[model samples]
Structure formats: structure tokens, C-alpha cells
Target: MLHLQHDRDFYAWANDSAAHLRAGRWAEVDVDQVAEELEDMGKQQKHALAGHLKILMLHLLKWRYQPALRGVSWRLSIDNARDEIAELLEDSPSLATKLPEIAARRYPAARSRASLETGLALETFPVECPFTREQLVDQDFLPDESASGQA
Candidate 1:
């Protein structure tokens, strides 16, 4: 039970980190490097890291392409990411562990939309780059209180 809660908390934290990054909090950071780091993590670590990456990428898309939603603010993005990741984690047991690969496969489609928004001839979304588990965890950017009970 404790482990389960920890997993949940970790997932939530990851989602929030992603949201922060999307909101330009971590501007200039490379998402792909983050993703690669996540890919190298162990299963448990990967789960948590993936949660963060998904939130970040999702919010990035929302920010770049969905102007109406951008007015909603970063806090809302964090909250929404938390809720969305929670549901996704609950529904798909292996989602966290498999997120990097899943994301890689989805990158092309996501990039196309991003290109339209940036008006750049880039093949991928610069801000939507992947991140590693070590980078996410080591950053210690999220609220520690949120992971307290779970950890």
C-alpha cells in the first residue's frame, strides 16, 4: 500500500514538473535530453520520470497551439496534469514504465503540430524535448510536501 501511494505521488510530481517546464519555468531546457535520461532509469524511476515528461509535453502542446487555454495559467496546468496523470496511471499499469518509448513513437505527430505553431522548419518541438529520470529527480523543482507521505 505504501509503495502504491509512493508511485502515485511520484507520478503526480512528475506531471507537475512537466507543467512547470511547459509554462516556461524551465525555459531553454531540452526535453529530449530529459527523455533520454528517463529511458535509462530503472523501472520504478522510469515510471515517475515518464509521468513528468508526459505532463510537460502535453502542457507544451497546449501552450504553443492552444492560445485560449494558455490564459488558464500555469497553476491550472499543474493541477490538470496531476489529475490527468493520476487517471492515466490508474488506468494503465505500465504507462509510467513505457512512457518514453510511447512518447518517442508519438513524437512525429506531435512535432508536426508544433511546427505549425512555431512557424519554424524544425522537425521537432524544441520545448517538447525528452528528459531523463536523473534530470527530473535531481532538479528537485517540485513541491517536496507532495511527495512526503508517498516517499
Candidate 2:
């Protein structure tokens, strides 16, 4: 009934846990560690989604701010990020409700990254998110500074 110490050899612990699970050795399984691993997996997925959103928002900002410099690569990067976000949401439907929350939280980091990468002053981008939830995820959405704001 002794369990492998999770900190010492996580890989061994995982393998041993799986084997015990398959053998129906319920009492021998490391339930606490198993639960922690499952929780970690969900957290990883959320982090990944946030990361993709950050990249998407950054590229969108770059595309809007430097329209003259916009090229195929920027478009492709945006498309790729959208596709990834779509895939993640499709796989985890529960995330649909979290999209706005996640986007709101991650947008600042995205703006900061865009400013750093584009060599523009941080003040160039708005402190508040300029894009709506719809615009953030819309494949065709690109901010138009001409519509109402300065580019």
C-alpha cells in the first residue's frame, strides 16, 4: 500500500498510479496526488487559452497600429491564433463562459507585449481594451482607428 513519493519521481509515481488504477487496487492508488494532477491539467488548459488570447490581441494591436507595415505574416499569425482559440473552446465548451473574463484579465499583458515588441510607447495603446468581446474573437475583426479613434 506504500505510494511512490510524488516529489521524488513524478514519472514513476504516475506510472505506478496508472498500474494500480488498472488493477483496481483502490486503496493503493495515490488519490490525493491523482486529484492534484487532474486539477493541474485544467489549470494548464486555462493558462494555454490565456496565452493564445494574449498573442491574438497583441497581433491585432500591431496590425491596427501599424497598418502601413502590416504584412501577410501578421494576418497569418492572427489567423493561427484564432484557429487555436477556436480549437480550445471547441474542446472545452465550459470555457465559453470564461472567454470574456479571461480576455479581460489577459489583455493588459497583451498590450504591454505589443508595445515592447513594436517599440511604441505604452501610452500609444489604450489603458482600457478598445476591442469588444465580439471583436476580440471575430476572425474578421480588426480595429479601425479611422472609425472613431486615433491610430
Candidate 3:
């Protein structure tokens, strides 16, 4: 019944599936759907971490390259991304183990995105990320905005 409901009414399927599991009616539970949902939930967290990293990296790039344009909004964006990344890691400590992998995958997209949004040449930014993962997430880190000699 739950399996049939899964195709027809997803919400009903979820409720019925959970009810069966709690009641030990394992035979009636949709194990395949439940397993898929569990896997997706884990993926969601990893994807979230990757997204936050990209945003933080994008802001960092903008801050580094466009030092004169830096202002309160950019700082807020950097801080918000930093705080969310911290909160995500604190909630899912295991995600910390994959931070390097996430950074590698997300940085290119971030660089491209920053370039597109800033109307800068893609080549303007390095092909690889300049900031280390530690510095990327560091609360005090702002990617040497001083390099551009902006006050």
C-alpha cells in the first residue's frame, strides 16, 4: 500500500511508510523509497556545504580583486556565508572530513560565477583557488584585500 502510495501521493506515502516502520511492519514499508530518501538526505547536506563554500569563495574573490568596491554589503555576505558554513559543519561534523574535496569541486564554479557577476574576464581570476580551505572559512579571512593597495 505504501509502495503504491509512493507513486500516487508522495506525502501519504511518507506518512504511511513512517507509520509502518515505527510499528515494526517492515514488510509493508517501502524500503526502496526509504533508502533512496535517506541517501538523498545525506547528499543534501554535502550539496549545502558545497553551495556555501562557493558563495564564500565568490565573495572572497570579489573582495580580493575589487578591493575598491568592498563595502558593508560585501562584508555581510562574507560573514553570512562564513557563519552558515560554520553552522553546517557544527551540525554535521562528518562533513568536515570532505571539506577539501568540496573546495576543489566548488572553487571553479565560484570563480566563474564571480567573474560573470562582476563582468570581469574569466581569465582575470586564477584557474585554481588561491586561498586555502582553512583561510577560506576563517572568520578573520578576507583574502588580502590590501594587495590591491586600496585604503
Candidate 4:
């Protein structure tokens, strides 16, 4: 559980770091070391961390690629991407907290899927359980206004 929270904090820091980097606020950007530390926390931690990292990386890629190519308004793109990332994070509460009972009851299949989806990169940790949209909804893990449409 502590590991899970730590990974979530790492993700939040990485998101802030990426935002700072994008805004040219270099002094505020400081997530590389934190990311490394999160990785070093082991498999479970990596699993939780990777999902959040992947979303952040995806936004970074979008910010980098789109601006270089189409010149498609970077600010708007980033805003949209931020919303999407927030949605993804909200949808996966297990990545934020340890809910063993929820994991046992509602997320067994999702956990299995997350395991296969994350593969070798995050498999080394004991915290690599994957979750599904159905489980997320069933357990009401996400906020009322989350992407799951329950709100």
C-alpha cells in the first residue's frame, strides 16, 4: 500500500515535471531522479508507476511531435492531453491505492490483463495486478465524474 502511494506520488511529480519542461520552466523540472527511484522500488511499484509514466510519456510525445509537424496549437493539444491523462488515471484507482478486497472481488480479470499488457517491463514487481473497466465501475473506484460515466 505504501509502495502504491509512493508510485502515485512519483507519477504526480513526473506529470508536474513534464509540464514544467514543456513550459520551459527548466528549474522546476525535477522528475528524472524520482522516476529512477520509483523504478528501483521493484516490480509492483514499476507496474503502478509504468501505467502512469506511459500516459505522461504519451502526452510528452504528443507535445513534441505535433508541434514539430502540424504546428497544431500546442497549448490546446496539451490541455486536451491533460484531460485525457486525468481520465486514464481516474479510471485506474488501483494504480493509486491498494484495495486488496476490491482487487480480489472486482478486479481479478483486469489485474490479469494488466499483467499481460505490462509484460516484462513491470512484471518483476509483486504489485503488477491489472484491472478492468468493468471492475473499476463495479467497485466505484473512480470518482463520480470519472470517465467511466458513472458520475
RMSD of each: 19.8, 2.8, 3.3, 19.5
Q: CA lDDT, every prediction?
A: 0.50, 0.84, 0.87, 0.42
TM-score of each: 0.37, 0.84, 0.87, 0.20
lDDT of 1 at 13: 49
lDDT of 3 by residue, 1-151 (tens): 6667788998888888889899999998879889998899889999999999999989999998888898999999999998998999999999999988998899999999999988899998888777777887789977775453212
lDDT score, candidate 4, position 30: 50
Task: Give model 1 RMSD, 1 decimal.
Answer: 19.8
TM-score for predicted model 2 compared with the true structure? 0.84
| Runs with alpha carbons beyond 4 Å of true place in candidate 1 | 1-58, 61-82, 123-128, 133-151
Model 4: residues with Cα > 4 Å off, grouped in runs: 1-72, 97-151
**What would the per-residue lDDT of candidate 4 be over residues 1-151, giving only the tens digit for each residue?**
3345446786776676667778998766555665666567545543554443333323333332233442345344434534553454476544444333423442334334434544423332223323333433232232211122112
lDDT of 1 by residue, 6-43 (tens): 35685654665567688887753345545654676645
Error of 3 at 83 (Å): 1.9
Query: How far in Å is the alpha carbon of 99 misplaced in model 3?
Result: 1.3
Q: Candidate 2 on 39-109: residue-level lDDT in tens? A: 99888878888989989989988988888888899899999998898999898878878888998899899
For residue 114, give model 2's deviation from the true position in Å: 1.7
Show pairs that collide, candidate 4.
Answer: 43-125, 44-125, 44-127, 110-130, 110-131, 111-130
